[model samples]
Target chain A: MDENNLIKMELTVNGEAVSMIVKGGRRLLDFLRDDLHLTGTKEGCGEGECGSCTVHLDGQSVLACLTPMERAIGCSVLTIEGVGSPTNLHPVQAALLDEGGVQCGMCTPGMVMSALDLLERNPDPTIEEIIEGISGNLCRCTGYKKIIYGIQQAAQELQAASPAGTVKESVE
Target chain B: MLYRKYEVAQTLPEALSLLSSHNGAVVRPVAGGTDLILQLHERILSADVLVDISRVPELRGIRLENGQLVIGAATTYTEISRSDLVLKNAFVLAEASKKIGAVQIQNMATLGGNIGNASPAADAIPGLYALQADVVVCGPNAERRIPITEFHQGYRKIDLNPGELIKEIRFAIPAEGTGTAFYKYALRKSQAISVVDAAVCVQLSDGVIKHATVALGAVAPTIIRSPAAESVLIGEPPSEDLFDRAAEAACQDARPIDDIRGSAAFRKYLVGVCTSHAVRSACERAA
Candidate 1:
C-alpha cells in the first residue's frame, strides 16, 4: 500500500464511529466488506445498474459501489448487519421470511434497504409505488411477486409497530 | 482506486485553487460520484488527484434569486425533484430529474454531473435547453456564465476549461402563461437510458403561441434545439394538426445514428412523436 495515497476518513457506520486510513479512491463497498468485515452488503454489479450494493447514507439509500470512502467522511452509514440479527430481525426482514421473499438471497439486503427507504418517505405506498421504490433492485428469483408481498406485509407491520404515526428511522 | 489523492474542499475558492494548483497532474472535481467513480473504476478515466466538491457549502442548495432558479451544482437530483420551488417554478426540470435512472441513482446523481458527463442522452439536459438555462463556472481567475446550448460542445464534451469547475445552474422562471413539458422514450420506465427525449416550453398569448422552444436529446451529438419546429409553432394556434406539423419539422432536425438502444430512422420518427406529445401537453398546461 502506498502511504502517500492513503486518506484518513472519519465516519459513523452502523451507529459506531470509525476513524481509519484508507485508499483515497477506495469504494465504500470495499470499505464495508474488507476493512470493517461487514459482509452483509453484497456487490452484484460493480457498476450502478444493480442495487445489490445499496446502503443507507445519512438516512438516504445510495449505491456503495459508486460511493467513494472520502464521500462518507462525517456521514452516517447503515448496513444490513446494523438493521437486524437472527435473534431479532427488522420488520422488513421478518416479513420477507414469513412471505417467502428470499430465494437466492443475493438481493435481500439491498431490497430491505430500499424498502425501508420507501416506507420512510411514504408510509402507505400502493403496489405501483412499491415497484417504483425497488426499481433499482433487480431480483431474478421469486419473480418479485413474493417480494412485493413481503414489502406490503412489512409496511403493515411497521405501521402497527409505530402507533404514533411518525416516520420510522430504519436504524436506531 | 484510480486517484492517488482525495481532498474535500470546504469552499469554492479552495476547490478552484486545488484544481488549478495540481502542477500538471490530472485533476478532476468529483460531485455525487455516480458517473466519475464508475468511469475511474472501469479504467476508462484516471486522475492523479480528485477534489471532492460535493460538500462545498457554496456548491449545494436550490434557491430563487431575482426571478431565476439558482441551483448549486452539487445539489442532488433527489433534492431537485422534491423541491417545492422547483416543482412550482420549473416542473419540467423536476419531472426530468425524477425519471433519471431510479431512486438510488436519483439520490446520488447531480444536475452538474449530468452536464459534466456530457452524455448526449442525458435525461436532464433537454429540459435545460428548452428552459434556456445557463451554467456558472468558477475558475482560479473568475467565474463565467455560459448558455446551456453553448455549454455542451459535442458528445461527451463540454466547454469547461481545465482549471474551471461548474459552480451552479440558473434559469429564468417561466411566466404565468408559459407551459413546459418533457417526454423521454426509453426501453423501460426506470433505469434505462433514453432512446430519444424531448422538452418543449410554450408561451401563449390569447390562445396563440407567442414563443416556443423545442429541444431533443440522444438524437444528436449534443442536446439540440429544433429551430424548425420552433418556427412552425411560434405564431400558430395550439392544435393537434399544427403540433403534428411542427413535430414533422422537428424530425428533420434530428441527426441520430444507429445504436444498440435505437436506430436512426426510429429515433427520427420518435422525435416527431415526442415533440408532438410534448407540445400538446405544454399547450394544454398553458391553456
Candidate 2:
C-alpha cells in the first residue's frame, strides 16, 4: 500500500488525544487492537453479527468491526480498557463479578460497555430494559441470566451510592 | 485493503464531484457504514474508493416543512427512532427503526443506507412504503424524486443512478383519524433480521375504512404494497373477519422464497399472520 493513501487521524481514545496515520479502509476494531493495543475490545464476529467488538464512539455503543477507521478521525472512542481498571472497577463490572456474569469472559468487555452506555441513558432500567440493553452483546456461556442479574445489581448499587438519584462520580 | 482510498466530503457538491471523478473506479458513498462494512467484510461487495458523507451537515437532520416530514438521507436510525416529530407523525417508522438492529447497529445505520441497500428484509422500507414516502436523489447534473414504493428495482437493487446520492426522504404526515402500525417476525426479539414484516396505515371516517395501505417485507423481491389486501379494507368497516380476509389477500400478493432464515411456506404463513395483526392494531389505534 502507498503511504500517501494513509490518512492522518487525531482522536481522543480513553480520554487521551492520540494521532496516527492509518489506512482509510482499516476497521476500527483492527486499529484499536493492532495499532493501539486495546485488545480488551475483542473480535468475535468480524461481520458485526457478534458485538464482542462493541465500543463507545461519541458516547454511543457501536460495533468497531463495522466502523471504518476514518470515522474516528475527530471522534471520541471509549473502549473496555477505559471503563475501569482491574483494581478500580466500574459498578457494572463489579456487579458482574459479584453476580458471576463471567464464564468464558470473551464477551464481558462488550457486555460491560453496553451496560454502561445503557445505565448512562437509563440509570434504573428494568429487567426488560436490561435485556434489551445488552441484547447486542451475545454470550454463549453464562446463558445471559447472570448478565441480566448483574445489570440489575449494578442499577441498585449505582442508586444506593448516589442518594440524589444521580450516577456516582466514579463512573465518570 | 478493502478500499485503497477514502475521501471525506465536506459538502454535497464535493461528494458529487468525487463520485464523478471516480466514475470508472468502484466507488461507494458511505454515511453509516453498518451495512456496507458488513458487505465488504463478507466480500459480497468491494470498492476501490469509499467517499465518506457521514459528516455532511446538509444530509443529516429531521425536520417538518409544509406539513411534510423531510428526513435527511444520512440521519441515523437512532435519531429517527427517538425523534419526537417522527413519533408524532410516523410512529410506525420509528417503531420499525427501533427494530432494525440493537442499539449499536441503530446508532450507526442510516435510513438512506437501509433504502439504498434495497434488501427485501429491510425493516424500515415497509413502513416507508406504507407512509407513501418519496426519495430525493441528487447527482452532478440532475435531481429526481422517486416514490419509495417504486424505489426498489429488484433483490438488493435500487433505482439509483451512478454518481447519485440520496438527499432526503419526504412523506406527508398521517392525518387525524389515521393510524399506522408496523410488525416484524424475526428469529429473536432484537438484533435479528426479520423473517417477515408488515406495515399498515388505515384512515377511518364515520366508523368506515376510508383509506388503507398495507405493505409487506422479506416475503418478496422488494417491499411490496398489497393493493388486493388494501382494497378489502377500503370500503369495509373494521372487523376481525375483515382483517382476516385482508390478511389472506396479502398472503396471495406475497412471493416468498425459501432462504436460510425461513422456508417459503413459513414466510407465507407469517405474511398472513403479521398482516392481520398489523391491520388490527392499526385499526385499534385509529379508533
List the candidate 1 regions with Cα displacement exceeding 4 Å. A1-4, A165-172
Error of 1 at B211 (Å): 1.3
lDDT of 2 by residue, B1-287 (tens): 67888888999999999887975789999988998988888898999889999888879999999999999989999999999999888889888988988989999999999999998999999999999999999999988999987778888878898889998899998888998999999999888999999999999999999999999999999999999999999999999999999999999999999999999999999999999999999999889
What's the interface RMS deviation of candidate 2? 1.8
Give each model's clash number: 0, 0
Per-prediction TM-score to the true structure, in the order listed: 0.96, 0.97
lDDT of 2 at B27: 90
lDDT of 2: 0.91
Off by over 4 Å in 2: A1-4, A163-172
Candidate 2 global Cα RMSD: 2.6
Tell the DockQ for candidate 2.
Answer: 0.67
TM-score of 2: 0.97
Give the TM-score of chain A in candidate 1.
0.92
